[model samples]
Target: MRKIVHIDMDAFYASVEQRDDPSLRGRPVVVAWRGKRSVVCAASYEARRFGVRSAMPAITAERLCPEAVFVPPDFGRYKAVSRQVREIFLRHTDLVEPLSLDEAYLDVTRNKTGLPTATRVAKTIRQQIRDETQLNASAGVAPAKFLAKIASDWKKPNGLFVIQPHEVLDFLAPLSVARIPGVGKVMEAKLARYGIRSVGDLRSWDIFELERRFGRYGLRLHELAHGIDHSEVKPDRPVQSISAEDTFDIDRFRDELGPAIRQLAEKAWQATRKTERLARTVVLKLKTDQFKIYTRSITPGDSINNVDEVSALALLLLQRVELPADTRYRLVGVGLSNFYEPGQLGGQTELFGNEF
Candidate 1:
């Protein structure tokens, strides 16, 4: 059995902001740009009490917590802190897989520190992070990555939780199907219609029946319900895509999306600058007021060069939207994908298409 440990920093970006500014400590802080179209990057625990959360509209965050302090995100400082945290992880194990700036999975099955158990390794790492960086991290130790991810969030905010190999089935039984990764509201409701509300209920169904109903995903559901996950903790996973999206306060016609698309394109383009990889494809995503999603993509002959190029191509993709003129959209997104290394861009063919 694998001994996996998942570490999650508590409100990482906001915590860093608070740690740097003593006056901001103990106050509700929302990390985001100051604008009507801006979405929150992170919220301090104090802000969470007021129902503020990441990816929420900044206007909505202000409405929810009128007294909250809004700070712009400082990725430079956050990345520095993240590097410190990663150094702490390396002290315990080399098999670390970072999910984002704030969370990671470590396979401590054979730790470098000679820790007696994965739980000890996790505890030590969390303590080291606290002592070195003055940051609190929650950790979960389990025999599998999915369960470890879930356990990390169970107690949350500088807490630790462990799931023993023998206790996996019992631990998962009563949990809602939504607790399983990838089981979103749509899938949950579909499962609920078939009397599958909990992991235990999903376990009772035959694998064949599940596959017949939900296709390939049903097979995955069956395996997870039985406490079986074969996925390994892959370290140093490369970035697959980068994107930014926004939902508007009022539904808008397709023609009205230019400003928002440009804004999101700028955000996405800025994100791409942080990586050495080049993106060949530009994707534009739109969600109708009715919640139907459509995506249009284009691959230029060369990698994108600047925010202006991203904005121009994204706007061009917007022209490809075939939805009715009367159709109003509630959300739009801009993304860059089809990554290539610096020397690998020659002989690339331009491509364009739309996906449902």
Candidate 2:
């Protein structure tokens, strides 16, 4: 069995604030701007008790916890601390897949520190993070990523849980179907209609029936319900593309479209720098309220190397599409694709076009 460990920092941003400031430890703390439209980036466990949560509007968070302290996000500081956590993970295994700024999955079947058990490796990594950064982390050890991810959340805030290979099914059976990755509100509601409230209920369904409803995701859900995920821990997951999309609650105006597209393009461009890859194509995607999907793409003859070029190309692509004044869109997305290493661009001089 491949030993996998998932580590997640508890209320990452809010916890960091609490740890750095002694007085914030036991208080309800929400990390976000105190603006009507600003969303809570993170909420401390104390704030959670009052129904504050990440992504909730600051106004809603305030209404829920009137006395909660609000702090703006400090991304630079968070990234620095995240790097330190990654260093600790590297000491255990090079097969680390970072899920976000504060969470990662590590395959520790063979570790750099000669750890014999995944649980021990998790403990050591957590200890190192606490000692070096005074940050609390939760870890889960299992035979696969799915179970390990679930185990990590079993106990929150400086906790560790393990799901052995033989105990996987039992550990998963009673959990809600919503616990499964990608089974969001819509899927959960659909499953509930079928009386499939938990993994155990899902386990009773025939594989064919599930496949009929959810396509390939159905088959994957079946395996997950049985606590079987065979996905390998790939250490070198390449950055194929960087994209950002937002679905609006209501259709937006044409005048508002320009600003939204620019915002998404900027976000995508910023995300591209997270990986050491160069983008060769810019793409624009839109989904109308009627669920019609439209995509427009441009491959610059010259390598567009910076955010300014990306934004300009995105705007140009947007202008190229002829949308009716009445055509309201539910979603808009911007993306960059055809990523290559810096050295790989040397011979591709012809790829750059006048668009650049």
Candidate 3:
């Protein structure tokens, strides 16, 4: 069985802030901008007790924890610390796949550190991170990436959990279907309607029945219910997509999205310059005041050339919105996807002229 380790930094951003400022150590700390349009980037353990969470509106966080100390994000500092922790992981294994600045998956089936077990490698890495960065990390060791990820979150915040190959089924049995990776509230609700509440319940269904109900995803659920995940930890995975989004201080109507779309498109375009790949799709995303999300995208015959091209395409997508005329949106986003090497794109003419 392959050995995988998933390491997750504990409240990484808030922890860094707390570590640097001793006065903020015991107090509730929230890393976010101060505005209705802003979202919480991170919350300390103290803040979390008051129902504060990342991605929630900053205003809501403030309401939930009136005493919470809000601090703006310092991405430069966070990235530096992440690099330090990455170096620690490299000492034991080269098969590291970073999920974000604060979490990663490492395949330690054949570690360079000569560790006796994957658990040993994980412990050493966590300790090294704590010693060097003065930050706590939680780790999970398992035979598969998905299980390792789940185990990493079980005890959370400077914790460690292990799932041996033989213990996979028993470990996952009583857990809620929501614990499976990629199974969100929608999927959970769907499964619940079918009387499938726990992993064990899901295990009772055959792959044929699942596939008939959930299509290809049903087949995936069958495997996960049986504690099977064959995906590997790939280092330096290529960028699949890049996007920028902004929540408005007040809800806006469809016609008012032109400026926001252009601005976000410009932001996404600037970010794309950092990568060598070309983007073939322009996407426009909107979230209604009721929290429903919609996306419209177009892939021209040729790769998008410049910010203006993306901005124009994104703005054009505004007409594609089929929401009620009185509908208002709380958020808007612009994105570029379908990344390809320059060699993969041919010299084809633009397929759709901007007929707007």
Q: Cα deviation of 26 in candidate 3 (Å)?
A: 0.8
Residue pairs in clash, model 3 = none
Compared with the true structure, what per-residue lDDT tens digits does model 3 show for residues 299-336? 99999998789989998888898889899999999999
What TM-score does each of the candidates earn?
Answer: 0.85, 0.78, 0.78
Backbone Cα, N, C clashes tallied per candidate: 0, 5, 0
Candidate with best TM-score: 1
Better of 1 and 2 by TM-score: 1
| Candidate 1, backbone clash total | 0
The TM-score between candidate 1 and the true structure equals 0.85
Comparing 1 with 2 on lDDT, the higher-scoring candidate is: 1
Worst 10 residues of 2 by lDDT: 347-356
Put down candidate 2 lDDT per residue, 35-72, tens digits, no spaces. 65456778999999999987676789999999999988
lDDT of 1 by residue, 21-67 (tens): 99999999999888766668889999999999887778899999999
lDDT of 1: 0.85
Output the number of the lDDT-best candidate. Answer: 1
